[model samples]
Target: HMTNLAESMEADLKVHQKPSPVIVRDALGIFLSILFWSNHRPVQLDNLTEQIKTLEMKPLNLEERLEYVLKRGNTFLGFRQLNELVLEQRKLIAKR
Candidate 1:
């Protein structure tokens, strides 16, 4: 499923400058779902207000993905963290 998702995202990118929110959401959702099924928590998060939360979908390069997993991927990473990571990934590509 992941392979297929990745492939579909790649195809979308070939047509546009970025991937759609649906793609990112699906990918992340699948990843988190898998993580939940595993013995790990996937990510971590502290207190936060829902009003301050937001979600962004963006295309990801290999480097950004690695950085995200290394820098932000934690057991507490929730929707907000994922959204931030997506925005960061978009910024990284835009700057290039």
Candidate 2:
């Protein structure tokens, strides 16, 4: 599932010794937005492979990526998963 993407982001932050809580929050927000966006605008099953290549070249930072996601205006794929990710991020932030 895409939840792994959020977990991986947390691990990356830990490894980098990210110093600001703002950065972590921003990162998670961006990630969640992207995950939701993908579900909203799912790639055609027939063209999934080619679509993924284009998605990879998308904006790398939080603000730009989130802005892009917002423009799409689509529904989310998994509300439960998003909630779980929010909790996970909350716990991680609490630990700091």
Candidate 3:
């Protein structure tokens, strides 16, 4: 669940305060996209998840991964979540 990932991310933020939050936020976004897409369109979900899992095994940068997700992510909900997370991340960085 995204919430579970968020909770873990919260802890990671406290420890690796430099880059953890956005990385975890991006990860949560990926997870949400996967679960939502899977529930809605299983075929597409299967293909995309396979690709993402492969990328997970390597050194794909977050920006590149996010761009890929932006292409595959197919709902207002996912986009909204991405926007919110990015905004919230920016606000946090601004405070630092």
TM-score of each: 0.40, 0.26, 0.29
Summarize candidate 1's per-residue lDDT along 1-96 as a digit string, tens digits.
655756666666566535556666676766544433332333322321221132122333433453454443332333334545445554644664
Q: What is the lDDT of candidate 1?
A: 0.45
Candidate 2, residues 1-96, lDDT tens digits: the string is 335544544454456533244433454455455543544554343543355345432322423334343342121322223334445444544554
> By the lDDT metric, which is better: model 2 or model 3?
3
The C-alpha stretches of model 1 lying farther than 4 A from their native spots are 40-96
RMSD of each: 12.8, 13.8, 12.8
Estimate, for each residue in 24-75, the C-alpha lDDT of model 3 and write its tens digit: 5565555545433433433233454455454322222434545554553333
Ranking by TM-score: 1, 3, 2
Steric overlap count per candidate = 8, 0, 0
Ranking by lDDT: 3, 1, 2
**Residue 65 lDDT (model 1):** 51
* Model 3: ten consecutive residues of lowest lDDT: 54-63
Backbone clash pairs for candidate 2 read none
lDDT score for candidate 3 against the true structure? 0.45
